[model samples]
Target: MTDPDRPVAIPAVPRPKDRPGRAPAPETTSTYRLGQGPLRLPLWLRAVILACCLVEGLLLAAPLLGLGSARAVSLMLGGFWSPLLGGGTGLYPGQGAVMFLTYGLLHAGLLHLAMNMISLAAVGRELTRMIGAGRMALIYLASQIGAGAVFALMQPQAGPMVGASGAVFGLAAALVGHAAITLRRRRRSMAPLVRAVALILGLNVALTLLMPSIAWEAHLGGALTGLALGLIFAILPRRA
Candidate 1:
């Protein structure tokens, strides 16, 4: 028998084997990805450059390959001044419009083709980057048409004209306009852009004077159209 003040001993409890415990969460680490933009050329630039090269190559090769006469090709595929003149306007309505765009593809010689293609690549890449492929195309087409119309108005009696000079000038002017807008956005004056544009115009004028065969009218028209388009684009919201 236990005494009234004596302590009692308690039985030890067994540990459970199947009790659930909190599991450590799966380990995770942060990851990052780098973008590829500068390395890639836009599809529109590739297509246009390739097409220009191919068209010029085929034109040059046609005579050697016995496919056709180079002169005949130039007269037929090249833009003619006939529509501008009062001579045989029998061509269906809007035919003249088609010729305006095609004229840009035709060049007088290998040298002519080379110069135009080089300028196109240089200026086109910049404009493409600035305004994107679609807008670039619109500006180009409109420039071509404006050049043709201006040339016809100024030189209705002039001989057949061909080459991408008008379009090239347009791209140059477009660059100037773009630069001006960008500078203005930063609270800067447009003097630099204006000077650059003036220099370009002066050079073109000298070239025209030196080479009377060059169509000054077309260049001026294209440049004006480009300036307008660039200003309009500058005011619009931009997207990536």
Candidate 2:
């Protein structure tokens, strides 16, 4: 046997290799890619928003156009006519119910009217078609009422809350849900979509905090409700 050395050489320790490199990614915004869709409103949605807007405008202008009162804003907001005006609680049987529905039809100004119409003309139609007119209508009314509830509770003194923003935000939320599912089913990650949505949410939040002109409560409420409804709709069986 060979004589052992004074000290046996120690085996060299191995260092761990670095982790596998991830694919390189470029910096970008997601809303720029996802903020829109195929441009067209579905028929039922088009008919509804358009007809509603027309009726709302007609009613708002009615007093001035017919009764010649510069202060006839009452009709515009859909109120109960006084008993002296030939009604109890100033309302017909369905008039109070109309109040909930009418506010969406009315807007504080022309600009308010146009913005909502554009949104409805774009996304509302698709919602009605994909989910069916009945469910779509339900979502719209529910979104409006939900948003209205938030406004009535939080900002009652802020004058009558108007516009289709609540329902529009609901549509946005629904789209987000649908897209999320689509990506997942394809085994794709939602990082890009999430980041984009986060940016949108952040921007909206910032605006809400900074500006007194926006009704972000309705936006939040509508988005939440819409997301929930969309999730339910996705799992529900279609009616024959």
Candidate 3:
């Protein structure tokens, strides 16, 4: 009561950690700490993933819905066929052109879709972060078209090519290209890049030897396209 003439003392509040046997309260801020929250994917990336899943889901549910086997129907309607490029008749007109983009959305099976989507998510997330979604999307589209063209050119009699392997490969190649450029800027050895390229080629060769059905031509085409674009992007000055 008499402290008003001198100084007033206030007891300090006890922190959660200061309390005996009491643990600290969990953080409730809007920001999340490192490696603690759910991964937030880009909108476009999520949309792409959802679209692929939806297509696959619909295909799986086709028979249950009394639509009969839809795999063949979907492939015929959307799969990339080499003959179509050479003026072959399609179930619908303009399908030949549309197949260039649509083929990437179709997959042979769940395993195939899973592999492609995983790769897309991993590499795509990094690339999208480096270059905005628009450019990443552009790379993906260009890669798909390039892949289809190369597949058609190389395997003129090959069966319908489905899956996003080519686009994923393209994204990987772009990542490698960017890495190569960054290393070159630092005067580092290109051995790592060379090894990475060789490793990809070796993997493709191994997969082709084992499966014999892999569309390696498309992979090659996508890698080439992505590498070319990546190099161009790396060399160019960044925008302000």
**Clashing pairs counted in every model:** 0, 3, 0
Worst lDDT 10-window in candidate 1: 30-39
Q: Which is superior by TM-score, 1 or 2?
A: 1
Using TM-score, rank the candidates from best to worst: 3, 1, 2
| Candidate whose TM-score is highest | 3
List candidate 3 segments past 4 Å from native.
1-40, 189-192
Q: Least lDDT summed over 10 consecutive residues: which range in candidate 3?
A: 29-38
Query: What TM-score quantifies how close candidate 1 is to the native fold?
Result: 0.75
Report the C-alpha lDDT of model 1 over 50-129, residue by residue, as the tens digit.
77667778877887988777756565655746454455462455555567867787777788778877877888878877
Q: What tens-digit string does per-residue lDDT give for candidate 2 at 1-240?
A: 523433334444454554579553433432233234564655567776777677657656767767555324644346212221223342355654566676666565566677778776666756655676677767777877777666655655454456688877777677677667767878999998799689769977886787677787777777777877877786777789
In terms of TM-score, which candidate is stronger, 1 or 3? 3
Tell me the tens digit of each residue's lDDT in model 3 across 1-240: 343345344545444554667776654424223344445667877888889999999998898999876989888888999998787888888988999989989998898899889889988878876666777787888888999989999988775899889988988898888888989999999998899889888988998899888899999989888888888888877676
lDDT of 3 at 227: 84
C-alpha TM-score for every candidate: 0.75, 0.64, 0.80
Q: How accurate is candidate 3 locally (lDDT)?
A: 0.84
